[model samples]
Target: MKKLTMALIALPILAIGTTTIAGMKYASDDDRCERGERYSQEDRQKRNPDKMVERLAKKLELSQTQKNEVKQLFINKQQQRETMREQMQSLHKTLRGLDPSAADYASALAQAKQKAAFMAESKIDERMHMKAAMQKILSPEQMAQFEAMQSKRKHHQGMER
Candidate 1:
C-alpha cells in the first residue's frame, strides 16, 4: 500500500515538473530579451531607422520634401553604422584569437580599445548630425512633440528595468 501511494505521488510530481519545463520552453522563444527588456521581434523591426522616420513623419505631418531629406539623413547614418559594425567585428575576431596572458596581448587590447573609442566617437557624431537634421526639418511644435515622445520612451524603458 505504501509503495502504491509513493508511486501515485511521484506520478503527479513528475507531471507537474514536465508541465513547468514545457511552459518555460514555449515562453522563452516569445519573451527572451538578451538585454532583459521585452520587445517583440516585429516591434523591434518597426523601430529601425526607416520605419522610425515613417512613424515620426506621420506624427509630425512632414512635407514630402522633409520626408525625403530625413530619409537620406538616416540612410547616411545607417551606412556609417554598417561600416562601424564591420570594423568592430574584425577587431573582436582579432581580440578573440589573441591569448590573454601572452606578451602581445597588451598591445592587442590597446588596439581594440582604440578601435572601440573611435567607433563610439563616430556614433556620437552621427547622432549629432541626425539631431541637427531633425531640428532643421521639424517645426517648434513638432520638435516639442518629438521630445515628449522621447521622454515617454525613456520612462517606459526605465519602468521595464
Candidate 2:
C-alpha cells in the first residue's frame, strides 16, 4: 500500500514538473509589447537584416525615404558584422587548435586574447556609430521613441541586438 501511494504521489509530481517546464518554454516567446519589451527570436529568418529593418520601420512610423535609408544602413552594418564574425571564428578555431603540451601555447593564447580585446572595442565603437547614424536619420519624436525601445531591449539583452 505504501509503495502504491508513493508511486501515485510521484506520478502527479512528475507531471506537474513537466507541465511547468513546458509552460516556461512557450512563455519565452511571448512579447510584452505594451511594456515595450520584445522577445527577440534566434531564428535565421527573423534575424535577417532586411526583415529587422521592416519591423523597425513599421514600429517607428518611418517615411518611405527614411525606411530606405535605415534599410541601407542595416545592410551595411550586417555586412560589417559578418566580417567581424568571420574574424572571431578564426580566432576561436585557433584557440581550439592549440595543444596544451605545446611550449608556445601560453604565448599564442595570450596573443589571441589581445586580438579579441581589440575586436570587442571595435564592436563597441561600431555600435555607438550605428546608433548615432540612426538618431541622425530619425525625427526628434521618432528618435525619442527609438531610444526608449532600444533602452528596454538593452535592459533585456545586455545591450546587444
Candidate 3:
C-alpha cells in the first residue's frame, strides 16, 4: 500500500518532469526554425482562398468586386511564390550535390547563389506588383491602414529573428 501511494505520487511528477524537458528541448533557434518551416508548409497546404478573402473583406471593408479581384491576386501571387520556391529548392539541392573538392565548385556555388538571389528578387517583384494591384483596389485611407499593418508585420518578423 505504501509503495502504491509513492508510485501514484511519482507518476504526476514524472509526467511533469518529462513535459518540462520536452519544452526545453524546443527552446533553441534551430528547433524553432525547423518547427516554423514545418508549420508554414502545413499552413500553405491548409490555407483557403475563400477564407482569406472573407478575412480581408472584413478587415478592409472590401466591395464585392474588390474582394473578387483581391482573391484572384492572392491566387496568382501564391502560384508565383510556389514556382519560385521550387526553383530555389532545386538550386539548393544542386549546391548540396556539388563536390567541394572540385575545381569548379566555387563557380558552381556562386552560380547557385546567384540563381537563388534572382528567385528571391522575383518574389519581391511579385510582392510589389501585388501592392500596386492593392493600391488600385483599396481607398487611400485603406491603403494607409494596409501599409501600417505591413510595417507592423515586418517589425514583428524582425523581432522573431
Q: Which candidate is the best by TM-score?
A: 3
Residue range 74-103, candidate 1, lDDT tens digits? 777766766887787797888789899899
Give the per-residue lDDT digits (tens) of candidate 3, residues 1-161: 99999999999999999999988977875563555455467567567778888987898888999899888988887787778777877987898899999999999989988888888788788878889999999999889988887788888889534
Whole-structure CA lDDT of model 1:
0.80
How much does each candidate deviate from the true structure in C-alpha RMSD? 5.0, 7.1, 6.3
Residue-wise C-alpha lDDT for candidate 2, range 53-110, written one tens digit per residue: 7888889999988988998888889778778988987999998998889999899989
State the local distance difference test value for candidate 3.
0.83
Q: Rate the local accuracy (lDDT) of all candidates.
A: 0.80, 0.84, 0.83
Better of 2 and 3 by lDDT: 2
Q: In candidate 3, which residue pairs get closer than 3 Å at backbone N, Cα or C atoms, i.e. clash?
A: none
> Best by lDDT, which number?
2
Candidate 3: residue 68 Cα off by (Å) = 0.3
